[model samples]
Target chain A: MAGIGDRISGTFFLVLGLTMYLFVNPNYIESVNGGNISPNTFPNILSIIIAVCGTMLLFKPTTQQAPDLRSVAITSMYVLLLVVGLYAMSKFGFEYVAPVLAFVIMIAIGERRLHWLLLGIVGMPVLIWLLVTIVLGRALP
Target chain B: MVELDTILAGFADAFTLYNLSFVLFGVVLGQFVGAVPGIGPIMAMAIAIPFTFGLDTLPAIAFLVGVNKGGLVGGAVPAILMNTPGTPDAAATALDGYPLAKQGKPLKATKMALFSSITGDTVSDIVLITVSAPLAILALKMGPIEIVALMIFAFSVLAGLIGNSLIKGIIAAALGLLVACVGQDPEHFTPRLIFGHWDLFNGLPLPSVAIGMLAISEMLRRMSMAHGNKVSSAIINLDTGNPNDQRVTWSEYWSCRFTLIRGATIGTILGALPGIGSTAAAFMSYAMAKGTSKEPASFGKGNIQGIAASESANSAVVGANLIPLLTLGIPGSVGAALIISAFMIHGLQPGPLLFTNQGQLVYGLFGAMLMANFINLWVGQIGLRFWVKVVSAPESIIFSSAILLCIVGVSMATSGIFGVAIMLIFAAIGYVMSSFGYSLVIFIIAFFLGPRFEKSISQSLALTNGDLAQILKSPVAVALLILSVISFVWFMRKNNQVNKADA
Candidate 1:
């Protein structure tokens, strides 16, 4: 199980390193000033190190404590939910999206009690609003 | 040497009502999260950093220090009462603590842990106060080549010493350097890898990256562990109803004085070095205590000194880790790294120059640290019962609220929605890295030190006029580089031996 994940991460980093070195380095990192040390020198060295390490890991992966696939999937779901929820908050004012976000995440996390639901949905966001706006004098998105 | 008036003024600044109250709040919050499973001080510190933007520097830093100190004390509670340790550093505390709790002496175990924790932390802080200024003055003598070599040593030790695989650790650090290169290069101020996004023109916000990776990823991991029917939180009954188990008498406390001293010594020595964190200190102290004890068989079977050894060592690390951060601007752990950013946020640099430039403020931070130890002692006495109760907050609600807090914190710390988006992305990256057993702490440390490392490299290059062989001109640089190579080989050999034994 651990080897599988290690191998995958190795492949992932190898691809990432190659992309950064070949594509990102050429296009994104422009040489505005040429000095003794080029602007891209550090990153290029980093990318090569990453690629070499990734290659080493790919060939001879060691044992590690990898999380189960179910756990990873659950966390990924939470991440997607969070990304979508924050995007919704930006689209519709935080006042509207926040409560729903709170309510759904609460349900997803297995909160079934009514009072806790009401408080999590309505009370928590209001408290945050008060703290951010009224107390700190900052606006929430 | 610091002036008497400067020290006196720092005492005055730290003793204010405002500073005291904030420190108390920080301690209370620290204890709360420390007792609660699935959350730790780094997570708390990450979320709190953005909130402290409006506060004065001393109070803000003092509060975070309080949290870190209080966390060590509070971590021992869950380790004692339940078999589950609240923080990784507290795992060794459970060996003796749980047995003592099971023997109907929960109060005695907790009180002993709290007392020894405060004692060890105080001892470490006193050393920090006495030695830090001199250390900082000494650090001022190092040239750019030496600093660069020292940074290399830090990287080698951190990547080689931490985590299961040195390769994975280095990969994480390399990725951190890559991400750190996203903003404009320090030399030319020309953008390197912004991908045409102007928000990243100022670089990825530290709060977004730190909070997302440290706090949100941990929360997500905890949420994943919230199994069916286990999501509500563990409820352990602490009512043994024995009067003899309610307190630690002076004799009981004084009996383990030597053990506390030894633990504090081990912790302070290791904590000052980068990459050797409190968990290692705690376990090392526990092993040595058991080995040297007169009654070695009583170690895991309710020996009081075992608790003292583990708790004191872990707690002492909170103060001792700051020695490197304050003197050399190198963070030994994630907590110290966060404090460095807090200092940077407050327009205070943490290197040796801070001693010469902000003498009074530095002393004030010292004063606040000492005051927090006293406050932590007082609060731990009163809040032990409260912290035990705080651990019962449902994981579902706790993790959800943590996610919300991370979003809000990053948003407020940076621009509103854009920062939140970056945080979510990093949170995902953090989660994946976490799943694959990479050390996110190493990544953050490398990311935090990346700019300075790059600057040192650039400086070294310019000084030697791109002649890399000129590095040998400085004996100090050569010595540090040799140490780096020696440590890397030593760690790799040790790891191989351990792996072979396990296999």
Candidate 2:
């Protein structure tokens, strides 16, 4: 009865655990024969536990809610835009990218009102800039 | 003895106009965010934490405490009016609240919830102020082995109780532990999991992780919903202006006195314990109140006592949860965990030593908590109409603005866009984990405590010369280990029973 989400998550964890166990380094120079309780010990233990949990999840017959693909798609698109926006910020500075990101996100989320959109695009970035630069005295990225 | 004078001085500090304004502002903001359906207090607190960097420790902590307290009262509003609890802890309130609202007494139900919340919260704060000092004093005597054993017990309790599946909870905790180990090895001062990224030498910034998992992931989840603004349709009409239906008489309040007292006591006790969250406390109190009621069948049919039981218990949890955080350095709830991060950001380590090292600030925080209770009551009464309007505002705007705020806050705190990138990564992880039913609370808490766990175990190993037999020499550590084993077995048995029943 395990749903697609559980199966997918199980496979993910299993792969991740195995990869970390096989590849990650956990030793330091000060340890005795890589130390009985070296840094790797905890991570190794955790990896084993996760791998076991993943195996159990794969085999366990339990009900799970199905993932919403449509919502996932929309959220992915939003995240993609966000990443792009961050890149743009790096290129053109926060002041330029902030309002544009806000405007695009508001529209994407279905905000149709012009005034609200304007407020978000124009007002939010300026307010945040003032708060960061003047009040907190922190440099904007 | 000195604690008394520190407390008085704290009261004086908290009463200043500058500090009081922050408390008021925090409560107001908490109520607004709590009244909103998709956003909750934890997210609000996360977004607000970066703002506290500029303020002194007292005002900053006071502001955050006010937000946490205000959220307790504000959550009840949506439960009473719309039958949609704003926070998970307030879900039990809707059982009786919606029915009461339907009987044309929405105002009455909201007022009852508010009064009971304030009363419960104040009493819990009193318990916290009184109990935390003694507990911290006791904790000061604990060795590394005892601390290690105690953390194991906490992990077991959290993994066992917080989420539906114990296996998933443990898996989440394991993931958290792995993530926590990404920084330098505490003992050797060498990098453990930092993959050639100098920025990660300090490990994953806490503010980024917190904002990502709690706030950004939540926004992503809400965005993914088909009916994006469905909560807007659940708004109730509270403008009836009927004086008779609006006010709760003294006799009515007195009638539910026993229920409120019992609920508060239950919440206080449960909140002080690790892993038993406010939601459980509220439901447990509601069940007990119903079982003891003269008319049990009226429980879900507009019974005021039902509202009293749920509200009092949940609100009581807000203050009582701080007990373990301040005393043992273990966060008893997600809110407490976030507060712990704030403490770290402020350069104040929370635990037994906090009382001795920073007694003035600790007592100041206590005074602030007391003041927050009064602020919650006063602000909640005057701002009800304003909050109703706020809740109805477009979700797109709120969430979009939230995105902007997250970027601003993270960028400001880390002074770089790198934190934003880290936040997005964790947000994706959090979204996936939550969608699959893993407990984010357990994950975040484990992450927070992971370093401490490693330090304690390493210290204990050094002390014991890697001999397990030496750990048994400490009676306190032995007792704690036994208790941890018992808790693990009990929770496993309980989980199996639940699975069997489900099957």
Candidate 3:
């Protein structure tokens, strides 16, 4: 399973590197005295290196230590759910969704008490707002 | 005369109210983060990086230096109380610390750790101040070729230091460099590898990368272990109900004084060297102490002396690592990188010329390093009990909070949705790597050197007109290259031997 994960990730990088080379061609600002190297040169070099490295990973595969699959699946699901909540809240405003999301995560992670969840669920956004608006004075989307 | 005056000026700058405040705050916060399990000094440094954008460089650095010193002491809190070490460096502390706690003497063990940490760190800081400038001066005389060679030496050393599997370590490092390439090229000012996103223009933000690779990945790993077992919270006897409990005696301190000193010395030397980290120093020192000790069995079983040796040595490295960073521009550790960032932000360049040109900044940084040890000693002593409680917070709660904080921290930096996406992707990758027993050290350090390596190689090639021999022309470059080769070969041989034995 772990080997498959590495192979999949490695192959994805190879494909991504190819795509980056194909799609991204940054136009550089040319100078009067001497035209410098374009922005694309570095990335193109990077793409080739990445692709090569990824392909090499395919051949000389190291044995991967197995993970506790159930735990990983649960945690990943929780993270996925949270990410979805964040994206959904982006529509209704983060102020509305962030606190609830934090609360759900806390509960999911074993905060069994309802009072603690309610307090955290409500208190977290207010705290974040105070930190951003009153202290740092940065606008949070 | 100028050197003497420079030292005086540094002291003057460091003694100021603002610098003192920054140092104090950094120390306090560092200790807080350190005491918490799974959050090391590097993570604290990463999280603090974004906040420094608002401050002047000197104060910004003073804070980070304090944190570095304080982090060494902070990890000992959990190691002593809960048997769960906050940082890898504190793993040695756990050997003796948990036994002490089990014996109903956690407070004494904790206090001994505090005292030894202070003593070792103070001594190392003094030594660092004496030696760092001369080394930096030597480094500054070297040309671009030597610099590139030095960087390669550092990278190779870092890779070798990580774990048993050399190729796996290299792969992780390569992955880091790849991620680092996501940002715009510094030399040409052209965006590289940013797939139609303006956010990628700046590259994967360092803090986001850090929070993901170190903080979030750790949280996930911890959560996996924690879900299977109930977090055993046996309230150990802190008050020492038994009056006969063996408190840390003056005689014990005197006997272990040499061990503490030796450990500190080892830590200081290791910390000064790039890639050899505090954890390595701690283990090396612990082994040395045990090897030389008359009572070797006393170690790994509630020996206050063992705790003292490990804690002090590891803590001392915090001060020693800064020696190279301040005097020379080269970062000796992740913590030093934060200080370097602070310097860059404040419009001060680190190196031999920095000491000559920005004498006050050098002096100020040095002074802050010294003062932070005292601050850590004072602050850590007072906050001992509170820190223990903080350390023993349920692993589940801790991991959850870490994940939440990582998400929030990343979001805070971008202010948009992009960083969140980046965090998830990196977190998944990090989790996958962790599952495979792959070390993230390579990834983190590779990410650190990526831009510099690219710039140095290109610039060196430009100067030599693509003559690769330029790397070997300079004696310094040649020496560093040889050292890298020797180290790389040694690591590969060792890895093969270990694998054969395992098989």
Compute the interface RMSD for each candidate structure. 1.8, 2.9, 4.3
DockQ of each: 0.67, 0.50, 0.33
- Which of candidates 1 and 2 reaches a greater TM-score? 1
List of clashing residue pairs for candidate 1: none
Candidate 3 clash pair list: B10-B363, B10-B364, B183-B203
Where is model 3 more than 4 Å wrong at Cα?
A1-63, A114-119, B1-3, B227-234, B242-247, B341-353, B396-404
lDDT of each: 0.86, 0.85, 0.73
How far out, in Å, is residue B222 in model 2? Answer: 0.5
Q: Write the per-residue lDDT of candidate 2 for residues B1-503, one digit (tens) a residue.
A: 23678878877898888899999999988888888877878999999998898889989988998888888777877777877788988899999988988988988888888889988898899999999998999999998999999988898889998877777878998999889988776776667777777798777899999999999999988876623342244556775778868877899999999999999999999999988988999999999999999999999999999999999999999889999999999998889999999999999888999988888888888888888888888998888767756656677777878888898899878768999899888898898899888889999999998888988998999888899899879999899889888988898788778767776
Native contact recovery (fnat) for each candidate is: 0.64, 0.46, 0.22
For every candidate, C-alpha RMSD to the true structure in Å: 1.6, 2.1, 3.5
Error of 2 at B280 (Å): 1.2
Docking class of 2: medium
Per-residue lDDT of B340-458 in model 3, one digit per residue for the tens?
Answer: 65565466666667867887777788799888888888898788877877765555455544554555556666666678777777777887876765667667767766777778676
In terms of docking quality, model 1 is medium
Sorted on DockQ, highest at the top, how do the candidates line up? Answer: 1, 2, 3
What TM-score, to 2 decimals, does candidate 2 have? Answer: 0.96
Tens digits of per-residue lDDT, candidate 1, B392-433, equal 767766676677777777888896899989888888899889
Which residue pairs show backbone clashes in model 2?
Answer: none
